[model samples]
Target: MAHRMTPPSRLLASVGLAAALAFGATACGDTSSDGPNGAADITIVTGFYPAQFLADSLLGDSGTNVDVVNLTPPGAEPHHLELTPDDVIRLAEADLVITLDGFQHAVDEAIEEARPAAVIDLAPAADLTTKAGSDGLDYHFWLDTTRYGRVASTLAERLTELIPAEADAIAANLATLLTTLDAVDTAYRDGLAACEQELIVTGHTAFGYLAQRYGLVERGIAGLEPEDEPSANALADLATLVNDNGVTTIFFETLTSPDIAKTLAAETGANTNVLDPIEGVSNDSRGGDYVAIMNSNLEALRAGLRCG
Candidate 1:
């Protein structure tokens, strides 16, 4: 019998407390206020790095004074990230906060308490009950470029509203953003359109929408939670899938343990490689950002999926 797993809240709390101690405390404060002469200080607390990247891009380098920070540590489960007391203070004082619903449970709690002036819940406010596009309750929306565009648009609008003077610039910025995203979409479409392999087997099920958009089948070792290990039956089934589909590559995420993937690759005699879901960048991410990570994933997919 498969054992039922606990949700990530407990896990996040445990990790968060430890990380808070290790990293000590760092709070992002905006000294410049909404005074007559100064621009409002903007600090965005994101659940992950991709969200932070999008925030930075939308806020722009000039006109908008924004500081973006990731709440999840490197190799941590995003769904389980809990906010420290310091994190709560950051959320309470921020001019605006963006959340991808269940992605940051701890941050959500703080938001409820703080009730900031502007809160953009990326969960569509309309469908909190339904699971995110795919993989069942997976909150990693940034991986899906299509859904990501919607969230990016919302972020752009919210940032514009927060800093009304930058509205025109924000519009232009969003236009540029849309164009870039379109290019990404085209890249995937063209790259994977006529692939010999239609199935993408990965460590975590983060590419639900990406696979859907490119018309590829996604088979994951674990469910939504990256830390969750598959059952014995699940592994056996996955092995069968690999053999049947003639799968030559097994993808693993950068932020999770690759042991299972390594074992599978050895058993199936398939090649193994890192296919980043871009959850969050560790301090040692080598200054990698959103575009760099996603573009890397695109290239890896093309090579691994044998889509030449």
Candidate 2:
């Protein structure tokens, strides 16, 4: 089990919107709705793409009236996000915020001080049981579509409680979202049912939850955090595992460098392919949205792992 961390719901008074207006967070809403200029003027700040995706889905059409802000920009690593003064002010002024406290240190600090109107920490809903890199909790729960679906239900229930007027719409959207997730789960289950290799080597340990759910083993060149560089001995051991286990493909991430993975693949005489963490979407990402990207990943896994 990962070291249990608490996500606070400290709902404090707003710190006035003037600070955010003054600072002008240029890189706001990378995966969000319109700015805080909607009809309801309700601001919802999501820490990154995973939570942002759920908010976008559950809000249904009411997203037009709600201002959804995502703090992390496209193509950036969510684990090491740095917030500016305006970002903190945005946190303070937001009507509701969805964040996983332990994942991003800077955002966690900002949330403590900014104290938005309502903060829903996703750790409780995510059920992060998988441990990685020295027994730390793997925060990439959304990669497993089933776990992501469960989190969606939790978010929908809480959102309906907060905004009762949109309850009906949220319910309708929840049905649709759940159906999609169910289908994705089925696809992954079937697609990876019979593969030549069950081990997935990657740039980092972000896929622990996903791998655990799908009954595949995961090895990373780096540790849990993307920046955790591996020792030379570790790399040599992973290369030997690749050769011994017949693991043909070395998976790299979209946000991080491919050098380490590629070098290992060359040493082991294996191939390299992309295995996106779906942390932040970008033009270079495999697909535009969650479902599409997941399907893209399935195809890559089947090809690389020699799935039957």
- Top candidate on lDDT is 2
In candidate 1, which residue pairs get closer than 3 Å at backbone N, Cα or C atoms, i.e. clash? 12-80
lDDT of 2 by residue, 1-308 (tens): 01112233332323333344335555444333444342245668877898998898888587447767789988898898988666776677677889997999887877777666799888888888757446788888899888898899999988887788899899999999999999999999999999988999988888888788889989988888899999999999998999999988999999989999999999999999999889889999999988899999999989988999
Top TM-score model: 2
RMSD of model 2 against the true structure: 6.4
lDDT for 5 (candidate 1): 33
The global C-alpha lDDT for each of the candidates, from Candidate 1 onward, is: 0.71, 0.82
Report the number of backbone clashes for model 1: 1
lDDT of 1 by residue, 1-308 (tens): 11123234532545543354234234323333233444346666666667777787776745755666666766675767877665654555566777877666678776665555567887882233323445457566677776778878878878877788888887887788878888888888888876788888998887776776788888888787776789989898999999999999999877778899998999899998778788777653423776667788888888887887
RMSD to true structure for each model, in Å = 8.8, 6.4
The residue-level lDDT of candidate 2 at 147 comes to 83
